[model samples]
Target: MYWSVVFPGMTEGQAKWLLPRAEEGLPGLLGSIVDPNYFISLHVDRHSAETMKEALLLLESSDSSTESKGIARGLLEAVDDWLDAGGKYLEE
Candidate 1:
C-alpha cells in the first residue's frame, strides 16, 4: 500500500501485482527485511505506471470550492508532515 502511494516510478497495478512477490522475496530480494518497520518497492511496469500517473495528473489539476480546497490542502499538509516525520498511515 505504501508502495502504491509513495513509491517512485511504480504504479498502483504494479504495486498490487508485486504484493505477493514482496511478501515472498523479502529474505532474498534485498539482502534481508527482518526489521519490523521496513518496506521495499518490488517492481513496476511501464504501462501501469503511465496509467496511474495520468490519473494522478488529472486529480492534481481538478478544481474545487474554497471549503473543499481548504480541507484538501490541510489533509495534504498533514500527510506531508507525517511523511517528513517518518510516520505511516495505519489503518485502524
Candidate 2:
C-alpha cells in the first residue's frame, strides 16, 4: 500500500523506507522531504517550536551521512527563519 501523503519524486521503495522513520517524529520525517515547500508547511503548520528544537538537536547529533545532515540543517534553518518571520513563505 502507498502512503496517503505523496512526496515529490519519491519512489515506492523510498516511501516504504520513509514510513517507519516518519513514525519516529521530526528527526525521521525531515530527511525524506524532498520539497522545500512541504518542509515549510510541515514546520509552520504541523510542528511546534519545541518539537522542531528537539528535532534539530537530535539530527545534529545523529550518525547520518554528512550530505543528509547538511540538507536537514539547511531545511531546519529555513524553518527557523520561517518561524521568526511569522510563517512567511521561504524563498526558493
Candidate 3:
C-alpha cells in the first residue's frame, strides 16, 4: 500500500487517506494522479507518462534525519526519471 511505501509507521487507514492529499502537492503532472478524479484522466490516456520534482512530500514525519532525507530524495528522483522523458516533460 502507499503507506508501506512511504509511511511505514502509519496504520492502514491513515495511509490510504494521507497518500492522495500528499500526492496532490507533488511537483509535476506525472505524480498528479493522487486525486481520484484523475482516474478517468489516467485510464483514458494510456501513455500519460510523467514525473514530479517534488520529493520528500511524505505524509509521514517531516523532521527526518539526513540519511532518511537522502533516501527519500533518491527515491523521488528515481521515480521522476522513470516517469519523465529525461526530466524534460509533462503528461502527453
Candidate 4:
C-alpha cells in the first residue's frame, strides 16, 4: 500500500486520528453519502500514491461542500507533515 510504504513510521493511533477526518470529508468530494468505514476498508490495502494524487485533483476540481474540502486539506497537510518528518516505506 502506498501509505504503508510512505508512512512506515506512522503509528496506529495516528492513523486512527487522521482517517476519521478524511472519511468525514470524502463524501463531500464524492458528492454522495458514503460510509466512511467502508471507504477506509476499501483503501486500506489498495491505495497508491497516484490514487491519492488523483483524488486530490478530483477534490480540487469537484464542486464539493466546504466541510469536505477543509477536511481533505487538513488530511493532506497531516500527510505532508509526516513526510517532512522523514517517513518512508521500508525497502523490501
Candidate 5:
C-alpha cells in the first residue's frame, strides 16, 4: 500500500523514491502496534524521521523552480509537524 501523498509537480521518479521511504520511515515517527491479526500498524524512529526530513529539505533546496521548492517545503513541514505531534493512525 502506498502511504505517501503526492504533491503537485512531483515526478514519477520522485514519487517512487519518496513513497516507500516515507512508509518505511513513518513507523519510527509514529508509534506502532501489532494487531490480533499480526499486522504491524506502525514503525519508525527518531533517526528515520530525521533522515526523511533531511531528504525532504534537500529536495526542497535543490529544486530549480520556486513552486517546486514551495511544494517540497510544504511536504517537509507536514512531516515535521506529524512527527512532532507523534503521528496518527487511520481509523477504520
Candidate 6:
C-alpha cells in the first residue's frame, strides 16, 4: 500500500524499487514505471497527448538514464502507433 499509494497497481516491491529513482527527477519518475504494457495503457488511455508531450520534453531536458529514457521512448512510439491506427475510432 505504501508505494501503491502513488501508482495504484504496483506491488510493494515495485514501489520500493522505484522510490530512489523517483526522488532524482522527472526522468526517474517516468523511468520508474518499468512495465511497458502498464506504461502504455496508463498514458495512452488516461493522459492527453499534450501531457505526454510534456513528459517527453522532461525526459529530453533532464539527464535521463539510458534504460529509463528507452522505456519512455517505447511508450511514446506505442502511443503514436495506436493513435495513427485508431484515429478514426477515437471520434466515435
lDDT, candidate 5, 1-92, per-residue tens: 22533265655576566666776876754322223355423345556667778988888768469888887788688678867876544332
What is candidate 2's lDDT per residue for 2-92, written digit by digit as tens? 1246456776578668777777765544434354445443424434654675687688789988987887788677667756766433452
lDDT of 6 by residue, 2-39 (tens): 12224667765876677776667545343344555555
Alpha carbon lDDT at 72, candidate 4? 74
Residue-by-residue lDDT tens digits, candidate 3, 10-80: 55467567667666776442232233334322221112322233434561247888788787777566555
Q: Per-prediction TM-score, please?
A: 0.30, 0.40, 0.30, 0.40, 0.38, 0.40
What residue pairs clash in candidate 5, if any at all?
27-43, 27-44, 28-43, 28-44, 28-45
For candidate 5, the 10 contiguous residues with the lowest summed lDDT are 31-40
Name the runs in model 1 displaced over 4 angstroms. 1-60, 88-92
lDDT for 34 (candidate 2)? 50
* Candidate 4's TM-score: 0.40
**TM-score, candidate number 1:** 0.30
Model 3 residue-pair collision total: 0
Q: Give the TM-score of candidate 2.
A: 0.40
Q: How does each model score on lDDT?
A: 0.49, 0.62, 0.46, 0.54, 0.63, 0.60
The ten-residue window of minimal lDDT in model 4 covers 41-50
Residue pair clashes in candidate 1: none
Q: Check candidate 4 and list the clashing pairs.
A: 5-89
Assess the local accuracy of residue 40 in candidate 2 as a C-alpha lDDT between 0 and 100.
45
Q: For residues 1-92, what per-residue lDDT tens digits would candidate 1 score against the true structure?
A: 23333445655567667666876877544322222236544343434444444554444567756666565556455444544555433432
Query: Taking the tens digit of each residue's C-alpha lDDT, what string does model 4 give over 34-87?
Result: 344465533321234335645865795689988888877776665555555665
